[model samples]
Target: RTVYVNGAYLPETEATISIFDRGFLMADAVYEVTSVLDGKLIDFEGHAVRLQRSLDELEMAAPCTQEELLEIHRKLVELNDIDEGLVYLQVTRGSDGDRDFVFPSADTKPSLVLFTQNKPGLADNPAAKKGAKIISIEDIRWGRRDIKTVQLLYPSMGKMMAKKAGCDDAWMVEDGYVTEGTSNNAYFVKDGVIVTRPLSNDILHGITRKAVLRMAAEAQLKIEERLFTIEEAQAADEAFTTSASAFVMPVVEIDGVALGDGTPGPIASRLREIYLDESR
Candidate 1:
């Protein structure tokens, strides 16, 4: 595979970052993942906009312009031959020769990196057919859940907890309501209505989430953005999640309880079809 590092394209093995980089030392970085379908980037503009928002929120500088970023994404997608995979981009505050609790000088340059992963059947994932079983975990992440930072240790641990419990993923709960899945935005359907938490600091505002909701609205699907609890989700007619990787994944069970015969619900399936159709 080929990767981009500080404006240079090289073999993945040759790409490197400083050990003292703020992104490595203090997790001071923002990142975005854009999926590719049919060798074309899906929602590149949306990802780029969100990337800028994350960078602005962190007071970080962009390594390059949006056009430059898009060109780089396309280049890596071509270089890596990623027909149906993802482009991962990261920008980190460059090293200042030493580590300190204080911020680096404004003159310090930021590091930019890009890479692609080749996924043969990213859109036609069989797991979407079987639906996902999820376990709920406490949301112990830092307060700034809105920023797309590289601080994924808790989410990784939550994924491990789900694996240990024989589930596909974990929904994080805070204040008795679901914040989101470990790596995706959470949602549920009930009585012909789609329910999810409103946008706030409580959850990461997902780019896929915004697109799915817009498509749902266009299809005249009813939506309710409010806080929901695990018990409510377990009793919902159906549930699903959205992310760059998994466009729309159905959830069949929650905390060991099955939802509607433990099958992927029709609404979730239709939305997935609509999403794939419209996105492609």
Candidate 2:
């Protein structure tokens, strides 16, 4: 596959980062992933705005203007003909001589990387049809998850633990409150009411999560953006996750406990339809 590094596009094997780059050395970077459907970018403007916010929060300059970035992303998508996949982009402080806490010189340019890849069709996966299981792990991420930074070791480990436990994903709990999934947003439905955590620095404020909320409102379903605990989730009538790839998927069980009837529920299916319709 072709990858865009800095201002150039080349084979993925040829794309490289400097050893001294802070992104490589200290995971000092931010990223955004947008799904491409039939060559059309989904929620492109929103993603771009969030990217800018992340960069600004980290005190890093955007490598290019929003229009330029969108053009580049479109070009890369066309160049690769990635019709049904995701576009991943990242920006990081540039390489510098070995240093621990000091910032790189102002003259240093930020490193930018872009790539696109096909995502497995979750709808076609039987696991999704049956609704996957999830495990609740303690939220061990840094306080700034709102920045969308690439430092993901804690979640990575959490996901691994989830996998080992025969679950499809990990839901992170903190101070007895459920935050979100490792790479997605968590939501549950109770008596036709959709409940998800409110946007905060502790969560990523997912694009799909926002879309789901909007869809629920249009569908006349009650929406609640507040903290919900694992115990509450386990008792929910329906549970699901949202992400760029997995638009909306039901969670039949959590932490070895079955939710409702232990199958995809009506509310999750309805919301999934709304999500796809609105997102497209």
Candidate 3:
């Protein structure tokens, strides 16, 4: 695979970053992932907008313009021949020759890097058909989740916890309500109404979440942007998650409790279909 590093495109093995970089040393970085289907980038503009928002929230400067970023994505997709995959972009505060707890000088430039992952048939992932089972874990992440930083240790640990428990992923709970899945925005349905937590610093404000909610509303599906507890989700008619990678994935069970008949429900299936169709 080919990768981008400091304005240079190179083979994956050749790309490198400084060991003292702030992003590596202090987790001072923001990132975005844009999926590609049929060789066309999906929701590039949305990701671009969110990327800027994350940077702005961190008091960081853009390494390049949005248009330039789009062009780089296009170039990498072409170079890698990626038809169904994702473009991952990251920007971090550049480093000085010496490491310090204090912020670097304002003259320091930010480092920009991007790469493509070829996931062949990513949209048609079979896991979406069989559905997923999720276990709930405590939300111990830092509070600034609204910023898409590269600090994913907690989420990665949650995924491991789910795997050890024989589930697909983990829903993070905080203050008596389900915050979100380890890597995606969580949702559930009851009486044909889709319910999810309202946007806040507690969650990442997923780009895919915004698009799916809009499409659901356009199809006249009722939505309730309020918090729901894990017990409530266990009794929900159905459950699912949305992310750049998994678009809309049905959740058949929660903490060993089966939702409905322990299968993907019609509402989740239909929304996934509509999302794929409209997004393409």
Alpha-carbon shift of residue 222 in model 3 (angstroms) = 0.4
For 20-128, candidate 1 gives per-residue lDDT tens digits of: 9999999999999999999999999999998899989988888999999999999999988889999999999887989998879987899998989999998999999
Q: What TM-score would every model get versus the actual structure?
A: 0.99, 0.96, 0.99
lDDT of each: 0.94, 0.88, 0.94
Q: What is the lDDT of residue 146 in candidate 1?
A: 91
Task: List the lowest-lDDT window of 10 residues for candidate 1.
Answer: 94-103
Top lDDT: which candidate number? Answer: 3
Cα displacement (Å) at residue 25, model 2: 0.4
Taking every candidate in turn, the Cα RMSD to the unseen true structure, in Å, is: 0.6, 1.3, 0.7
How does model 3 fare in lDDT?
0.94
Q: 153 in model 1: Cα distance from truth in Å?
A: 0.2
Candidate 3 lDDT by residue in tens digits, 1-280? 9999999999999999998899999999999999999999999999999999998998888999999999999999999999999999999998986688888988888999999999997989999999999999999999999999999999999999999999999999999999999889999999999999999999999989999999999999999999899999998999999999989999999999999999999999999999999999
Distance from true location, Cα of 230 in model 1, Å? 0.4
Runs in model 2 deviating more than 4 A are: 120-125
lDDT of 2 by residue, 203-228 (tens): 99798888788878888989988999
